[model samples]
Target: MSSYYGRPVLKEPVWKVPDVPAYLYLGGMAGASSSMALLAGLTGRQRLARTGRLAAAVGATASVGALVHDLGRPMRFLNMLRVVKLTSPLSVGSWILAPFSGLAGAAAASDVTGLLPVPGRAAGVVAGVLAPAMTTYTAVLLADTAVPGWHEAYRELPFVFAGSAVASAGAVGMVSAPAESAPARRMAVSGSVLELAASRRMEGRLGLAAEAYRTGRAGMVLRAARAATAVGAGLALLAGRSRAAGIAAGACLTLGSIATRYGVFEAGRETARDPRYVVDPQRERLRERESAGRGEVH
Candidate 1:
């Protein structure tokens, strides 16, 4: 089979834009929020804890809805549970998300209703343990795929996603919780720094494969996202003094997080459409194998 630069050798992702990325964004937000909730609750910051719990519950539930909508059939989503596929990230994610939604929801309800404190705390602990995994599993999911952009960039995807998740959760808390949320502000700044640095390093390492991040539609979106992240982090640093600044920081961080997801999704699509990305890597591996064989013979 002849592979052309413009033609796709692999099946293009069936996932539509905004939807799949939105699912990723929401899931990260949910997971991070759950973590924030646990920390706040343990620290006795009642208001911040309440906000985090609500965000966790709402984000997780809504993300499930988005995933189901993307699947196009609720029954199809159900069918996924007929058996366990250890190698399938989607399957693993489904199991994680299902229990997480319940735990987060129950915790949120307990907080809202002023009842079941013990169970709520227990659930929050469990959810917190699962939160980082939930935030990061999607990165592994994308990297395990055949898409050159995702697979080749595996080294950085988890950290990038985790940072994005932290920023997203912090942004939500900064906007909704009281001005005393120092942890939220710090999280926004720190996570943005981590995300931007990791992404830049990933692109630097990609060589020609980095084309997915540097040119075309994905590049444009990522550029905007990078700007938003930097500006947001700056605003978050200044947020200690000004309420308005905090709001602006929160808004920018949220936008940056969403843009990051969309940019990543577009980059994967671009990578899949380019034949050179797939071919060159395989060719190099083949050359290495040939060299090894000759060395063995000698």
Candidate 2:
């Protein structure tokens, strides 16, 4: 039999991006802001803590709203609550988000009321722990999809997001906190460093998918991220940091982080749409299957 050129391509889900991108942005902000609130409370920045908590609460609410609104049938969103499928990353994520969101709301509310009970301290601490995980886990959730760029870059995605979340939250803190606070500077610096490292790791570890991060719009966003992270962190480390510098850097990091997410997701859509990613891998599998079949027959 003769083989034909220009074979037909297979496709994955065709998602309307408006909601997913917004959801990703909101979720990251919410998680990061919550982390900031917890840290501010610990460091005795009452005003910062109070403002940060309100910020987190609003962000979190927006996130949940975005999530449901993204679903065409918003009413059916409640169906997700009834299931527990460990193998499904979205399912696992929904579970993780439920309690985390509740706790974040409680913490934010306590800050507003000026009655953060000693017992509630335990809740805030727990929420603080869950906050980072909430941000990190979304990377895992995106990667779990049968999307090439996302699935292949799995190992580095969580770290990338973690660093981005920190930077994003730190930026918000910079807006709210006084410039001289050592903790805020440290957090921003830490986030910037981690984000830069994680981006490098993504470029290094993922050979093909890394191309997504390196070219066109993706490249532009990543390039900006690198520059911002490096410069921001460097300035913070040197001369003991300044509010203006920190704000600028944080803005860059926040923007860069958001762009990265969109770029990654877009690349995955491209990967899923392209015949090469699906065909080549499947062809290899078929060859193996044929060889095994022949061997069994013999």
TM-score of each: 0.95, 0.83
Candidate 1, superposed: residue stretches over 4 Å from native: 1-6, 295-298
lDDT of 2: 0.71
Give the distance in Å from residue 293's predicted Cα in candidate 2 to where it truly belongs.
14
The runs of at least 3 residues in candidate 2 whose Cα sits more than 4 Å from the true structure, single-residue gaps closed, are 1-12, 115-122, 235-241, 281-298
Clashing pairs in 2: none
Candidate 2 displacement at residue 136 in angstroms:
0.9
Q: List all candidate RMSDs to the true structure.
A: 1.9, 4.0
Q: Summarize candidate 2's per-residue lDDT along 124-243 as a digit string, tens digits.
A: 677777788777888998777777778877888888878777766766666566543455557667877787787788778866666767776657766766776666666555424466
Q: Choose the strongest candidate by lDDT.
A: 1
- Candidate 1 lDDT tens digits, 1-298: 3485556777778898667999899999999999998898788888888898999999998888998898999898788777778889979877888889899999999888879988987887898889998898888889999999999989999999999989989898888884557989988988999999999999998777789888899999999999999999999988888889889999999999999989998999888877778888888899999999999999
Model 2 lowest lDDT segment of ten: 1-10
Residue 209 lDDT in model 1?
75
lDDT for 194 in candidate 2 is 83
